[model samples]
Target chain A: MRLSYPTNIRIIKVPCTGRVAIIHLLKAFEKGADGVFVAGCLEGDCHYQSGNLRAKKRVAYARRLLASIGVDPERLAMYNLSAGMGPRFAEIAREMTAKIRELGPFLQPSGRTAAPQATAA
Target chain B: MIMAKAKPLEEILSYLEGFQRILVLGCNGCVAVCEAGGLKEAEVLASALRIQNMQAGDRRDIQELSLTRQCDKEYLAELKDKMDNYDAVVSLACGAGVQFMAEMYTEKPIFPGVDTCFIGVTEEQGVWTERCQACGQCILAETGGICPIMRCAKRMMNGPCGGSEKGKCEISVLVGRDVDCGWHLIFERLKKLGQIGRFAEPALDKDWTLSRDGGPRLIIREDVRP
Candidate 1:
């Protein structure tokens, strides 16, 4: 089923969410992504075992770092979903897109809207 | 190993205020092992700084470098050719490494990225406990390998003072964690070694001159001199 999600979202594939380090998430924001999210396998269902959990921790850390720099920590988030939940994946995409839209475009510390860049992982 | 923690981001940013081009330097020695100041940490800091700068509408040039060990002249020599590229450096090494780097490159400003905590051992993946004070005296033989200077909140020579309760030091309340009473550990260790008699022996006042109080101590090994 070709469930449609917001086209603004760009997904970068990795072998596992564990492979997504803090730098990767921060770099996305540094490059001007309005929002970023790590879509990992559902907790306890990670193919590589604990990859999703590791991603969860890293996402939390990155969020704190973002908040420290005055960025909206809500701009970065992590979600867990199984491979079979394509509809839920689409739903999450819509939900995040709406949230980001309501939060408006991410502004640099200078208060200027950042140039659009890839926004999800 | 030396244990350290990152300084607050605001403090580090303040150091970079006037410097447009910055180098975030890391040490692959003790700071690396403790997960405080290493190549990965350097990258994370660099990225965060970049994001902060971009948000502030400031175009700051930030780069990263990691030396095998910043305290060694041989390793610091690697920066000889790269020093001219940046106006200042943010070092993630321990205090000694930062000082050594600052001394070598006198023209540029060097700031510490992490606060050096203590000489410690990794109790677990993310837990580190202070183990030594480098007091210039070794008394592990008598104390059963437990150090009193660093562990005991009061630096008790003969202790388990009234402040010690349930094997924890009174200072533990202020630190928000249970700190093992140094004397309690000593007693237990000495008992295990069948040297409980050592506890009865009075300890003389520690020689303050043998410690940092003596001021910048030095050692000369003629046999190893080139």
Candidate 2:
């Protein structure tokens, strides 16, 4: 099925969401991404057994780390969906795009603004 | 191994307010084992500082370096030429390592990126509990291998104080968790060894001089001083 999502969203593929470390998430904002999210296999349905669950914990940890550094924790998020959920993926893309837009550009601790872009990795 | 935790980013950043060229140093010794200060942590800190500086509209040069052991003079010598390039250094080593680094590089200010907690063993993947206080005395043989100095909220040489409730130390209330009473563990261990009678024998007052109370202690082992 052909589906269209927000064009501002850039998707980066990985072997599994669990491979996404806290540094990777912070790098997105460091490089000026307004928002970043990880879309993994549905809960308890990870291909590598518990990769998605691990990713969930990492995402939460990254969120807290961001907050500690004065970055908005809401800018980072995690989502779980099966491989075949094309429509759901598109819907999430749209939802995230709107959320990032509302949050405006990612602001550095020093009050400077970074260009707006949303990333899903 | 020595256990430590990363200092808050805000605190680390505070130490670098005026510094433009900075090095976030990591040690691959005890700190690395505890997942506190290692190559990965150095990279994380460097990245965070860069992002913070970028937001502040300032151009700062931040780099990452990890040594085999910052406490060793040989390992710290690796920074000889590199130290000249940075205005300041943030060490992710324990308190001792940080001081050692500062001693060698007298010109540049060295800040601690992690707060050294204690000598401990990993209880699990992410949990670390203190195990040793380095009191300069060996009492484990008599205590059945459990240390009261580190485990007991109040270091009681001859104890199982009145505050012990259901095997938990009374201080557990303040910590919001059941902390094993060290004496209780000692009692149980002695019972299993058929030496429960030893528990009643009053231990002599501990020699405070052997511990930190006597100030900084040193051992010059001639055999190892090559």
Candidate 3:
């Protein structure tokens, strides 16, 4: 999905982005986010002090995993900004959308999405 | 910390393409803290997959469940009733979790959401480097806690391999230190413990049968199991 794709991009606001984990980013892609980015407070400026740094670390790890999985690591990103940085948030969105446009829609094997409905064991 | 990269997005995407519903499992242990697999990873992957499906115009239902620990039976037990609800179980835990989940449900396909890399330790914040081979032996008292099984170029038990170049192993540049071999780290540690002599003792071959050969391993506690 392109960042510009309607409702494709989601921003999950947490107590802090550091609360986000690498798998969360992966799941997003697995579920289908052409690109994902985490926007947190500026470095050394987290309201919770270490939260932004933590978010950065998590995003880094997620990007690495995305790259490993054949997903463009560029699909996932982290930015530092205050909660009120509307412009910064928009910038992230624009950047991500552009990246996704280049990568194209998530290409799954078989060009299918639905696995067989899970049957009760 | 093992430097395991996630399976490329294409690979993971392809695996889930045919599945209608997917459950992404997460472990809060090693992978969680390192930002690999954990609650956060489960949520993120779920979200990404959902978006992927949606944007692709696929109507698959991607579900999720994150447990505190996938390696532990007690922890996995939490999902007993919920296991059958999903088409596939995408375990964010290491490879063992995939097998465990597959074993538990026998019928459902279990997938390793996270590629379990190697036995490792955090070299720094969010940095994991492999340290152990888990050859079914515990000889850390000898090597100063540095695992030669993983650190040595040849997984040597005796000492530095002939290929060890200036403390660096021929296997990779990452395995060595400029002035100190990983062996040095182990020696220094043992020396501090006044256990340097223990390093000289030989290790008997570890019995592989004690591990996977035992057949489906089980640790049932009457108090916990019904």
Best by lDDT: 1
* Interface RMSD for all numbered candidates: 1.2, 1.8, 5.6
lDDT at residue B49 of model 2 (Cα atoms): 84
TM-score of each: 0.94, 0.94, 0.63
Can you write out model 2's per-residue Cα lDDT over A17-92, one digit (the tens) per residue? 8788878887888877888889988998987899889889988988888777767788888988888898998988
Chain B TM-score of every predicted model? 0.96, 0.98, 0.77
DockQ of 1: 0.68
Pick by TM-score: 1 or 3, better one: 1
Question: Lowest summed-lDDT stretch of 10 residues in model 3 chain B?
Answer: B171-180
Report the C-alpha lDDT of model 3 over B1-226, residue by residue, as the tens digit.
Answer: 4334455556678777678878878777767877778776677777666655655668888777788777778888898898767888778887777787777788788877777888777778657776776655566655676776566555566656566555555546553444345665666677788977765766666565544555555566999866
Query: Which should have the higher DockQ, number 1 or number 2?
Result: 1
Q: Kindly list the per-residue Cα lDDT of model 2 for residues B1-226, writing each as its tens digit.
A: 9999999998998899899999999999999999999998898888878877766778999999999999999999999988889999999999999999999999999999999999999999999989999998878888889998988878899877899999999999999988999999999998898878776688877887899998999889998877
Q: Mind giving the per-residue lDDT tens digits that candidate 1 earns over A1-121?
A: 9899777777888888889999899888876788888888878887788888988999899989988887889888888887788898898888887888778777633444422233232
Q: DockQ score of candidate 2?
A: 0.55
**Per-residue CA lDDT of candidate 1, range B23-134, in tens?**
9999999999999999999999999998888778788899999999998999999999989999999999999999999999999999999999999999999898889999
- Docking class for model 3 is incorrect
Better of 2 and 3 by DockQ: 2
In model 1, the runs with Cα more than 4 Å from the true position are A107-121
DockQ of each: 0.68, 0.55, 0.23
CAPRI class of candidate 1: medium
- Ranked candidates, highest DockQ first: 1, 2, 3
